[model samples]
Every structure is written in C-alpha cells, then in structure tokens.
Target: MKSSKLSIKFRITFWYTLVFSLILALVFFYIYFLSKSYSVHDLQEELKDESADILENLYDKSSRNDILYNADWTKFYDDNVSISLYDKNSSFINGVLPEHFPDKVPFINNKVRQIKSDKNIWLVYDYCYEESPEDSIWVRSIASYGHWSRILYNMLWIFAVLFPITVFISAFVGYHILKKALQPIYTISDMAKEISFSVNLSKRIETSNTHDEFSYLADAFNSMIAKLEKSFEKEKQFTSDAAHELRTPISVIQSHCEYCLDELKLTDSVREEIEIIYKKTTYIGQLISQLLTISRTDKHSFKPQKEEVDLTLLIESVIEELQQKAAYKNISLLFEYIPQNESYIIQGDTMLLMRMIYNLIENAINYGINGGCVWINLIKNQENTDIIIKDNGIGIEKEHLDKIWNRFYRVDKSRSAGEGFGLGLSMVRFIVDIHGGSIAVKSKPGYGTTFTVSL
Candidate 1:
C-alpha cells in the first residue's frame, strides 16, 4: 500500500499528458497546413490582381498601334511581382523574368497557375487585353514560393519550442488538479488507518454538502462503520451480561457439590461423578470471570492498582505453586534469573501481573511433553525487563498462533482432549496490556512453544 500511494497520480498525469499532447499536435498541424494553404491561395489572388492593375495602367485602350511593342515596360521591372508581355501567338513580346524563372513555359489566359520550374516553385497569372477582335496581349505575373516558405519555417520552429513546454505545463497542472480531485480518497484512507490502529469506531469522515461521488462514498463508509460499531457494542454487552448472570448459578452448583462431599455419605462412583461436575463448573467459572475482566477492560472500567513488583521472585513463586501440577506429568520446571546489580523490580498491578505470568507458565505445562522440561527466565536491564517462558511440549500449528490470544479459540486437538478452555492466553494478553506491556509467542507444530513478555 505504501509503495503504490502515488500510483494513481502518476497514471492520471501520464494519460492526461499523452492525450493533451495528441490534441495539441493535431491543432498545431491544422493551423500549420491551414496557413500554408491559405497563404498560397492568397498569393495567387494577389498575383492576379497585381497583373490586372499593371495591365490597366500600361495598356493603350485608345491607341491603334500593337500594344505589346508600343509600351515602355521598364517601370514594370520590380521585385516581388514580375511583369511580362506575351502575344496571342504564345510568343514572348517583351518581359522580365525573375532569376531562375523558366522562360520556356507557355502562357494561358484567364486563370492563376502554380508551376514548378528547375527545382523552384513559382506562381503565374496571365491577363489578356484585346487590341482588336482577333488580336490580344498577355500581361503575366510571377512570384517565388520561397517568400511564404520562410514564414512557414519560422512557424515550425515556434511550434517545436512550444510543444514540450505545453506538455510539461499540462502534466504539472494535471497532477495538482487530480490531487485536489482525489483529496477525499486520501482523507478516507487516513481515517481507516486511524481506526485500525487505535480501534476507535465512533469517528466519522466529514463530507461536502454537494451531492458528488465522494460525498456518496463518505456516506457509505460512515454507514458501514456505524453498523459495525453497533453490532460490536451489542456483542460485548451480551457477553458482559451473560457472564454476570451465570456466575451465581455456577457458584451455587460448586457449593452444593462441596456440601455433598463433606456432609453426605456417597458411593465411590457417585463421588467421582460429583468431583467431575465440580471440576467442570470450576473451569466454567474461570471462563466467566475472564469474560467479565475482558468486558470491563473493553469498557475502560478495569483500572490496575500499580505497585512495585519483584520480577525475580515472581517467576519463582509461580513456578513453585505450579510445581505439583507439573509433577503429575513428570514435567520439570526450571527458573533462570540474573540480578545485574539493578533491583529486579517493576511497577504494575501485582495480582494482574502475577496472573499474567501464571497463565503463561500453566499454559506451557498443560501442553508440555511428559518427562520434559519448562524454562522460566527473568532478565532485567536499563532498557526494559523481559519474562520468557518456554516448553518442550506438543507445540501449536502455525495457523493457530495468531488466534491463541482470542477468546474461546483452540486448536482441534485441544477441543477433542485438553485440560482447559482457550481463555487463558486471552486473559494473559489482557493483563499484559493493562500493565502497558507486550507479549509475543513463537511455536512450531512438532517442536515447542515459547512466550516472551516485555515490561
């Protein structure tokens, strides 16, 4: 997710610039060719007009002499527009041709023409004047195509300079525009991260009043979160209330079992059955108590009473108390401690902290191998204190590692045949959390499991 954070903006900018460049190129080509075509058309019209103007001035409409021979044509020898005279027989009477202008080209009247001559393009126009009904003189105009070509070359150079600049400006502006357009998406993502990290569900994303797609997305997200928060609240409330309601009946059952064993004479089989009932009720009572603890913790009602706890002696006491239980399975409990010149002490809830360690060690013993060993270690330093409990037992599968800290989640083997329900690790995690510490577990299926707590 972090790697692809900028991916959306990159794709938007890339596609936007590509499309903008194509459109700009099309517009550039349109304008360029339009200028070329229009310039040539206008030049042809100008040649026709220039020739007609010159013929009107030079022609002798009243004189009876042959007009081509009688006229003095030196005034017509000028740059930009060339003037030439031709007879009706298509022979050159008198004229001036621009440099490299092909002289062999025959003249035709009443139209402007573009002709290529010796690698040069020239525009030619002919105007006819009648000396009589059957005799006439032609006034021809010639201009080079190079004059307009220079203008087009400069235009090409200008476009060459502006194309990349326009594309760059377009991409830069497009990225910022898309960023603003997608800002609401970023807001939603940040809110999601905040909710996941802090586990806070009441926060809602702010949306604009305008009925846009982003507003709709915000509405959907807020609606889903509201439903989820409501559902979780109902679940937690049910759990809390059920645990409270069942506690009294479980205590009454245990009390009756105790009274039966102490006061009434019972047969061997009846006593064993009663003992099993008492044991099962005791486990259920523990489970209910853990559920209540978690419920109170979730509601922010369970505050730990902090006191200085001896880190070294705590492990020893738990190990001593659980020694008889381990002896039943022939599992040896070992304690490893180092003073390091500093007091092996930490500030936390004594009962909760002791229970935290107690649960971990008991969990190890329950799953431990017969005649195997369990190691409980206490290490202290300036940085922090660590409590490590490890066992060579029937280890957990990789998939069950994450779910062990969740309530009532046990592996299939434990469900079929295990001493306790899967609430011990859940309570252990809660206690560690209440003391502002962290716990981690590592295990392999066939080897063993190890628990590490840091305070």
Candidate 2:
C-alpha cells in the first residue's frame, strides 16, 4: 500500500500480454507479406502463360513478315490487364495500355518489374525475341498491382481488426492463468495477516503435491510458523515460571524488611535502606505480574470478564485516584464533554479497562512538565466511544514514535531511570485490541502528545 509499484499478479499479466502482443505482431506481418508475395507471383505467372500462348500461335500460323498481324494480342485486352509490343529500340509498336501507365519504364528482356506511376503500382513483364536476322520484337504485359492483390488487401484488413482482439483475449486468459499459478502466494499472505491479527502461530500453510517453487515456498512458510510456535511456547513457559518463582522471594524480602523496621530499633539510615529494598521488590512484583498477564494473553488463556460499565464514571474515578500523583509536578487535570443524561456504557472487564485508563493517565502525569496540563475528553457517536487523553508533556521525537508501543522500549536512553518500564503503552494497545477497539497516538517534540482510544 505504501509503494505505487504494481502487484505481482498484475505485473506478471502485463508483461506476459506485452510479450505475446509482440510475437503476434511478427506473425501477422509474416502472413501479410507471404500472401502479398503469392498474389504478385500468380500475376507474373499468368503474364508468362499468356505470352507463351501468343508466341505459339505466331510461329504456327504465318511467316515472319505477317506473324505480328496474324497473332491477335487484342485477345488479352482488359481494363486492368494489357498486352503490347515494342521494337528492338524499345519504341511502342502496338497493343493496348491503361491511361496514365508509365511507358517510360524501358523494357528489360525476360523479366518482371514493378513501375509506380499515376499513384499506382504497375506490374510490367517484358519478353524479347528475334523474328529474323534483322528484325526483333518485344512482347510485354502490364497489370494493375493493386487491382490484382485483393487477397493480400483483404488479409491486411482482417489483421487490423483481429490484432487488438487477439491481444485482449490473450491478456484476459493470461491473467487467470497467472492468478491460478500464484494462488499459493496469496494463500500464504492471507494466512500471515490472520496470524498477525489473531496472534495464533499454530497454523501452517498447505504445500502442493508437486515439487515446484510455489510448493517449496509453502513448505518454507509452514516451517517458519512451526518454529515460531515452538519459540513462543518456550517464551510463555519461561515468563510463567519466572513470575511464579520470583513471587516467593519478593514476599520473603518484604516480610524480612518489615520485621527489621518494626521489631528492631534500627537507625534512620538502616531503616531507609531496608525500605528502599522493599519498594524495589514491590516494583519487581508488579513487573512480574505484567509479564504474566502478557504471557497468559499469548497462551489464549486471558479472557476478559465482560460486564456493563459506564466509561464516564470510570474515567472520572481514575482521574481522582491519580490526582495526588499528578500534584507532585503541579500538573492540572481537565475533563471535557461530561455528559449530563447520556450514559456511555460498554461490555468489558471493568478492572482491566480501569487499569488501561490508569496506566495512560499515570504515564501522562509522569512525563508532564511542571505546571503543565492534561486533558481527558469523552466523545460519543453511533458506532464508537472515543476517549481522548491529551497532555502538554515533553512530546516524543519523530523517530521514537513508532517504537513507543513496543514493550520495555524507552526513548530517553541517556537517562538512568524513569517512572515506567515502557510497557504501559504496549499494554494499552493490547487492551484496546482485545476489546475490538483501536488506539492511535500523535506527538511532536516540545509541543504535546495525544492518545485516542475508540471502543
């Protein structure tokens, strides 16, 4: 979609049709020239046959003196064909010729030549012989080349009409052939898109019975999916095992720290050190919980407990809950378009939806500048309910915008620490997708960032 280049199917069909058209044109021209050659050859042969007949009569009927008078050349006269005679000096002696015929074309003995005159091609045949020791005559025939080439003319007309038709038919049939041949690629692409959407890796593409390139491609795709499924299974097991195993240690550390602070009369420095350990341990527990949630979703075990919850009240409550956190930076929170009578209700797991909203607002508050403001707007329509969270924070850079939704991806690499593990936006994306909704973000450095969630 991003590139204007043509699809493989269409490109293949286009090139196939173009090559076929070239070959077809060559064949048409060959047939045209062959037919024209045959028509002209037939006319030349007729002229030779007629000249032979006249000579035979002249030799058999009279003496050399009266031979020209006895033989009737007028028998060959027609509108488009003519028989004539000339002397040894090439002077016109007798016979008929069409009007505007090019008589200037001198006779060449025993040859057929073409002459162009009066905007027409004239086929002229000259036959020279001796009647006596001192007398010679030339028998010649002239025929209208255009008038006698009807077969070749008709063939050209037929080609002119059939050329485009043949090209069109070839293109149509070639497109279907290419489509059928490349169906396996299409099948693989469609399956890949489905896997991407549903996050299911157990499916495989079907290979063909024959051992061709397409079949090889299908086998490769199936193998890749099988590997992904195996790797995904390992990752899922590891996260679950790690989360469960770390929970006991985290609890043990927290309990020991609490006992040390409460039971022992510890110094201020010692107590603060223990408290820091407890806080870091708690943060680790939260991280493990997030990893477990993502793992369960991947395993198809994290099903939402759907219930009707009012979105407006839920958002307002989340804002109130995070008010103390935002006050740290003196950032103000504003809510807009609070409906008076209309209730914006949706079916989802209330806790998960609240977590989704909480994470986004918390991220805004964490990233916001001192004295900055965050705006939350509720937009209702016939099809979808939109929640817009906009903040005048230090906006993300252009290069980092796309990567912000990736898990554990932090944009500010120079900084040692930040409030989030960079998983909040990733979790938000997953939540919206699972609920059959969508999310989008817009940000520009030093200006603001906006998150739109449509359900």
**Segments in model 1 whose C-alpha atoms lie over 4 Å from true places:** 1-10, 54-79, 85-140, 206-220, 262-264, 300-310, 343-351, 377-387, 413-417, 427-440, 452-455
TM-score versus the correct structure, for each prediction: 0.79, 0.90
- Model 2, 1-455: lDDT tens digits are 48758889899889888999899989889988887888888888877877776566557645544545544556657545688777888887667777778756877888989888757788888888686857778888888886756666788888899989999998999899888988888898999998889788887777768999988888888898889899989988998999899989988998998899889998999989998998898889888888877777667656888999899889999999999988988999998875656689988889889989998898888888889999999998889899999998888888887888898888883111247777788888888988999998888877778999999
lDDT of each: 0.83, 0.83
Task: Tell me the tens digit of each residue's lDDT in model 1 across 248-348.
Answer: 99999999999999999999999999999999999899989888877876763457899999877777888889999999999999998865766788999
For residue 237, model 2's alpha carbon misses the true position, in angstroms, by 0.9
- What C-alpha lDDT, on a 0 to 100 scale, does residue 438 get in candidate 2? 93
The C-alpha local distance difference test score for the whole of candidate 1 amounts to: 0.83
